[model samples]
Target chain A: MNEQMTQKPYVIGLDLGGTNSVFGIVDARGDIKATTAIKTGGHTTPESYVDACMEVLLPVIEQVGGLDKIKAMGIGAPNGNYYNGTIEFAPNLPWAHDTVVPLAQMFSERLGGIPVGLTNDANAAAMGEMVYGVARGMKDFIVITLGTGVGSGIVVNGQVVYGHDGFAGELGHVTMVRGAEGRLCGCGRTGCLETYCSATGVARTARELLQNTDRPSLLRELDTESITSLDVSIAAEKGDELAKEIYDFTGKMLGEACADFAAFSSPEAFIFFGGMTKAGELIMKPIREAYEAHVMKPFRGKAQFLVSGLDGASAAVLGASAIGWELK
Target chain B: MNEQMTQKPYVIGLDLGGTNSVFGIVDARGDIKATTAIKTGGHTTPESYVDACMEVLLPVIEQVGGLDKIKAMGIGAPNGNYYNGTIEFAPNLPWAHDTVVPLAQMFSERLGGIPVGLTNDANAAAMGEMVYGVARGMKDFIVITLGTGVGSGIVVNGQVVYGHDGFAGELGHVTMVRGAEGRLCGCGRTGCLETYCSATGVARTARELLQNTDRPSLLRELDTESITSLDVSIAAEKGDELAKEIYDFTGKMLGEACADFAAFSSPEAFIFFGGMTKAGELIMKPIREAYEAHVMKPFRGKAQFLVSGLDGASAAVLGASAIGWELK
Candidate 1:
């Protein structure tokens, strides 16, 4: 793929997830085109996973409209790293922990000659926000995504906190409740913020609220197997007291978590993204109200609350493109 | 000061408060053999303040040790900056406003050989914690001093986060309560973290607790002006329910505040210092318990709760010494 490319420089973006692989062609202005998504081979075999990724990527290149414009490729994985240019053990991916260079090598060979850069999805989101999202002009802010799980990315003094070993901004895992030690989490821990604040968290909370049974609700009519965060959102929007309470509880938790973040980085704002947050004001009102009740003073009127503007499927694509624009 | 002290390589530590000015000779290991405190001369004039500082310093230098051990100096003032080596508009001091090099010039003349470095009290405390306190091994931690007011010194990635403009860590001013705008603070802001979580915050809470009825104990027994944080701590220790409740409330708020911070820098711990923290387990237990109940998950069990081992008067000296050690 690289050998046939022309003189015009172009960039590629890759999003690595548990069930699917996505790649896109982007340019300097952050526009993404020719996006392709392929089923991620279960992480059982590393080589096959690489092959599946290449399968999705090559076609995206052809869709790049004009290959002459492609210059570099940026990969956004669960645990991608910038310094080492490798991904170790990412919990979401089933493959055994290993360096990600082999896959990059494959992509480079398949796509002809081009440079590849990498970073975690959260960091990529942070870069994306700085590059083209709400935090465009601000040097400091944190982005939190509430989806299947809650993921956070921190930007301090205009730069991301990658930690010494590249595991810095793990706010979702910061414990907020007692007995959190044994709670089941994707990271093998219990009571994670993600466990309580993500879409999954909302579902868990709804189940718990339903379990108590002291409170009557229309929720009982839904089939047990299909009740979801969307149902809760809709119910709350319809003024179901139980659903409202769940969102209030969840938003309060998210707000309190953001307040804790304010004390450390003193950023100018918190930008939120993800499907759960799509509940919009349903989740945001509680977060803002709770944040006001708990945030440190300097942070009170200073940090604004923002909802991400990235389109659903397009979110990861832009984040990947932003990674390609690293240090630009 | 900079030129003459090239070879000797020593630093001085000056702590200026509304009540007094302390001068000490600090060496490479953060040791202070000579230290002395003197009146600010109500020091209506900057020259008087400087002269008084030298008089107090010179005698102490001769009495306990000598000038031979000193090299340079670090000043902990209301608004000093090590970056600009200046004190800009110290709010509490008698001087009107915008004081800087004029004060440094006087010190250089008096010390005759040492240079001066400047930073606020909180930053100094953070440095002290990093070099001489429990935070010895951690690259990231927050040192919060719960004194007359709340002040925080933030160290991230092993260094202080001096924002792009040099005024980074201001945790106390972050508002925790919305429209809790009526409480008074030194910075003139209402509902500040300092208003709720400092030594003064304790007294303030006690006052609020005492509003409905007459408490028959130590605090009410003393003249209103004389009521101290120590008195409240004693009452809480003796099982005063109001005092216990006050601490519990504050702890919960602080825990939530810390949870917000967890989202930002993701520090390893938040080390408590200052007289109010002397409440010790009473304060720490609640803080830990509430922090666990409120902080972001990944930060749970990861950031420890502890008190500073450094003492009051000695901390500034040690911190100043650390400044020199770290720099020169």
Candidate 2:
């Protein structure tokens, strides 16, 4: 639409995770012209974190013909607030855990005042899917990221729901189980969906099953404390009965939860992201079966559940960069 | 904004409940200029029901000068679908129970081709609140109606969430308790919020509490089968401990449910409507307290809990009429 927009064919995307901050200079087609990463938790303060980020990012910017070739930058981080372009009290971010960091503004100032946008990682993934991945052309759908924690990005009437506090899509925290017997969650809640459906939750479930039942499985060979979702997947692939049951349990809860979610926004599809989706049909089959069985009558058989279409390695960075395309 | 809009200064609001179809001709200020009603279940056919409605409506149409003075019509009915302007499978509507009635189109055809709109009662009430009640200027809020059944109208980013289907805001049916011990709901589900928080649910709670405990109260004088929510409210007002405890249980479940709803939309307010809200602080205090106690840390104390400000007698009709104002 503009001369500069056509001339500047790339935008910067920063996927700021607890372990690493990945930087990608992406073209409009989702092609990563250049990419780099730096350890995130090494910085003692927000200011120092941004300083370290710039050192790595400057070279990537130069690789893509300098800052002028980039239209804007988008950051996907834990607790990133789209409305204010700040990361607020993100527990896993060392520099932002206790204080709200105006990371977008700081980056914008250093990058010659180009527009910068920010949102939580899940929402960024939703934007990515909408822009160049599976959710393209879909006006309404939900992107669910099932990693160590479960996160959601809800789209209604073609826009992501940021809500009143810019933190609306916290579906993982919605109470799946109601009382004392429900598992304790990281948020200090009991019986949250994250307590049962997240990747870590799957491992936890595997541990519980291994101890509670005597069914022989490959998982029992591993040290119980060190069990991971990957181990469970491997066992399930090998037709381990206990591991399959664990997936059944996990997928049942996820499907049941999606049924409830349908009652809320009734999206056209539900896109799954993160490590848990990698279990493929072992996980998806039960999710579909449970969703059909549990969904309200009007919504039965209406929503499609699918895994993310983006490349797993670059998906986070692409998702973060997708936010840049919409920055004004 | 137009000559005809100024000339036709009124719209028709029909609150089509199971027992009564209350119709009102309202002006821009929510003033009822003319009103009428018809028994909803008296007719054996949808056509006859519309005939009965037209017979009474003609007089009101004349009383308001003429049909030319009315700009549009809106119906707030059980199972009303906004997208199609139809009442689909309304179980309590005797003539329309198993059929989809093009009620809005029928009204439009009968009223000199005037435009008409229809939506479920809760969504109508939400529109009413936005246009003429306490929710004025609010972009995001949830209106929960606790009557014979519980219903909700969810607003996000200034629009009522119609979802993929017209039936989006069914918060009444969201599962609160998820096991065999949970109450069975009219929707054939167990442990729905409606089974615990509706006016009928309040009576059910009263029966459960009275039968299970030996606590003395004014409600003991009444037959358990015939005890109404009104009786419980009166007993609670009279300082009956058991009655208060019933409110506490009902309020606690409702508060917890609202906390979950917050995870969906993070609404700025939760507006209460219908007969149960008449309990005033008896119910409101507990709902507010529990919401604050249970909501996510980011959302705690941020959302205001309030009662609907519309006059109870005209609220439903006003709500329906509000939809008329938006009809194209």
Candidate 3:
């Protein structure tokens, strides 16, 4: 293994998203030496999906000095389980929605039995942050991905908390609103943190704000139904009051949710990831303020609030590749 | 250490309560060989407090074959920090109220430098459960102590989550109610789980139930202000409608809180400890029901809810002593 580590300086990373299966050959320093992609859809089964992936992935491996130079492979995918190295019942993946797909093993078998590791994308992001991003030196932190859905990866004592089941760190589904008043969530629940703080949640908030009040703002100029979180961010940057309020509402709830989280693990920091974090201090300031205001007195001002240090476009790939380095 | 483990067959356990400091000599099987107690409050300083504790503790040490037979000492106290082995600003301890007290180090110095460890009572309870109670052999579980105040010890991946500050697992302080309608907590926060779920919280619920409605029952037979959780339990045992309702309310809230907790670490079980658990299935039923009803679909029916296995009278001492085995 020591000899292998010296000879094989690269690892393959797969960021398996709903729309695209992106493959990157990453070095130890997180540099992408070669990359390729194929559409993640149109596969009838897990075997077919892997076949299609390999067609594009093989070229990248060859470009990175062939299979002998590759040490391992890692994958970041929705519903990926660290313990099982499988993607279980993922709603979005065409081939893995109902059955457990042994993805890491399949990849390992195809890649000449080099070890492969897999975990949910959020956990991958956390590993990326711990290795090459903002959480580099911290052992106790939470990486919260505020994307299409609010996802989380929890680290404690320098390891990801996989829980009794591999499906832990579902902070996005914690009920913020307890009763009938909560917004409906895609997970068949109501009032989840995801329903109020995800990218889609932010757009919904914009829609609700536009519908509930006649407040004059730049958001009113956009088509009400199609207003995305990005539109709200652009409007807020232009000093639009209502757009700023939308961020405040989202941030405040996020902060309050974090306050509850502090009572759970008291992480060293809360590292925000994904699209919603692009709002920057617009979202961060309110989260910090609400955390201080709502958290137990002992935890006040104890946690650092920061954004992911990994560049957005390559972060998922970097996060996935980081997992390869962890393979024994 | 192996030779010491064979020669020194006992560890000293201290359960430091606000009223009494109980000391016990415990063996590997959780048996108490000797025990004694002293009033915790008469001392004016931490030094004097330790001096007084030693007076009673030395006799127990002698009864258990002297200090040479003692491997280490463990203290379970309010606001105890595992990292520094100190009791920090514990309001219940007169000497430690406003000061950081190096109680563990002091004991170690007095006992010829045998290792000493200290942690908040909740974490100690968790350790106790893992080592000797219902959580034996379980790697992931939560031990919730529902005494006068609510407390918790969260174990993940077979380790107590002390967080970055050694002050994690404050689950009792998690907010159950989000808005102004939330109850005021002793922690200077509003709507904490402790405020609504502790033993005192149950009594408070009984009081509110009697006051809010004209329901005629055995609870109204006693003065409302003086009504204790014990009184409510006694009434409920006799099938008092209002008292049963009180347990239901408390259990429901606890269950809902556990549901939220499930989203955090996804423990295999939630072990109830301390006084309120005496309500038996009355409270446990509602908690399990609420947890299943409110938890995310994937987590439903996955976790077991159980009561502490240790005898209530000696559990705290055993919990403290269990920490001794973990020291390096």
Candidate 4:
């Protein structure tokens, strides 16, 4: 084991996104030794996609010493199934949208039969936290990614909960508002947590606050149709009341959702990730306050609320890399 | 190992409830060879409680052929913690209400230092289902006990979720109704699922239905304050419209809650246990309908809704006994 660890000191990580597929060769300490990228939709088929990925991935692998020096490969993608090592009907991936793509097996077959694991990006982020980020020593915690849509990776008893169908931890779709008053979600559901707590949800709160009342704020200066979460954060940083209220609303709903999540798993911590977390204590404070106010009495002061520890720019690659260490 | 199994062919199960503490000597196939009971609050202290328990429990041990025949002991009780083998501040237990009682260790010391296991009653019920009932051969499922209070035992990857603090799986306390209009819960919260779905909650619903409208029904003939869930069930069985509507309302809420639960763990099946299940298809049908209607598209029609396969009279004892087989 010691000899093998010394011989193969790195693993290949692929952050497979809608627009770009970033590949990285990483060591045990999470340092990205070599990195490369390819346009994700450039290929029209799964085989062609693997062909393009290998074209760029090979140079990076070679830069870090070759196939023998790499222990495994791990891919993080939308609709990835860890149980099957396949990408199943991912809507944003043109090559994988209508079918199950055996991307992990394809990569392993091309790379001298090295082990490869694949899972959804959110679960990858959780593995990253457990292996190298804020959740390193924690066995039970939830990672909530407040990105384009709300995504969750739930860890219980030191293992990610894959459920019976390998499709557990869909906390984003849990209902917040249960009736006709709820906003429509991308999942074709009404009143999902994603509809109220995602980055888009924050922007929607901004739009609603600006439109619903005559209260004066800096957010009114931006084009209502194109306002983004970053715009809301900047305005809040400048001490705009409406902008601050937007974060309060978003954070409050998130806290309530976390409280409900507590009833399910009673995690020790809730680690926030993605663009909304950049709001810092601006968002976290309200979340903590609301969580304490809404959570059951026994769980009131038990959980720690934290932001992701990984650097923003390379977090995805690191998250994808972390899975490689868990392949066995 | 086979010889040990043959020599110790029985295990002791304790179903410790508020009113009574029932003990049973059980075999591997869930057959009960001997059983006995004592009033749970008969003694004033934990030590004395165990002393009284031993007085009744020893006879059953002798009836099963002697201490050598017993492999282990398992206890199913309120507020039981699997990690520490303690019952932490269980409100219904007079001797344990204000302190953490190390009940499993106490029992182990008395049982000739045999291996012992303890868990919350709902979790024990889940273990029972997995080991010898409907969930046999299944790796993931949720067991919901709808007695006077709604309790849950969640199974993921074939293990009970203990979480970081050993207090996970309090699904009854998850917020179902979000605002002031929601009913008050015993957990000092408003709008908990237990406030609307338990047997008491069903009775409360029946009372409200009786008082809210002048729609004459069989329920009005009885004293409104004295109405029980059994009364509602009997009325529903006799074709009472108001009684049937009460069940529909309760089942619909349960189904909606199950829908939200699906977004969390995505269990392969949800097994319902306890008094409320006697309504059978009247409740289960609406629960299934509401779950499919409210769950995300990917999860629709995927999970099974099941009733406990164990006989109602002995299910609790069997559930407790099943935990004995799991001692490491």
Candidate closest to the true structure, highest lDDT:
3
Candidate 3 lDDT over A263-312, as tens digits, reads: 88999999999988889999999999999999888889899999999999
The sequence of per-residue lDDT tens digits that candidate 4 reaches over residues A153-193 is 99998888888888888999999998999999999989999
> In candidate 4 chain A, what residue range of length 10 has the lowest lDDT sum?
A1-10
Which pairs clash in the backbone of model 2? none
Candidate 3 structure quality by residue, lDDT tens digits, B218-271: 988898899999999999999998888888889999999999888888899999
TM-scores vs. true structure, each candidate:
0.68, 0.94, 0.97, 0.98
Stretches of candidate 1 exceeding 4 Å from the true structure:
A1-11, A55-73, A79-86, A97-117, A179-192, A210-221, A239-242, B1-12, B17-19, B24-37, B44-74, B78-119, B128-152, B162-314, B321-328
Chain A, model 2: TM: 0.97
Ranking by lDDT: 3, 4, 2, 1
Give, for candidate 1 chain B, the lowest lDDT window spanning 10 residues.
B96-105
Task: Provide the TM-score of chain B versus the true chain B for each model in turn.
Answer: 0.87, 0.96, 0.96, 0.97
- The alpha-carbon lDDT assigned to residue B239 of candidate 3 equals 97
Task: List fnat per candidate, in order.
Answer: 0.24, 0.63, 0.83, 0.83
Q: Which portions of model 3 show Cα errors greater than 4 Å?
A: A1-7, B1-7
The per-residue C-alpha lDDT of model 4 at residue A213 equals: 93
How many steric clashes between backbone atoms does each model show? 41, 0, 0, 0
Candidate 3 chain B least-lDDT 10 residues:
B1-10
Sort candidate 4 into its docking category: high
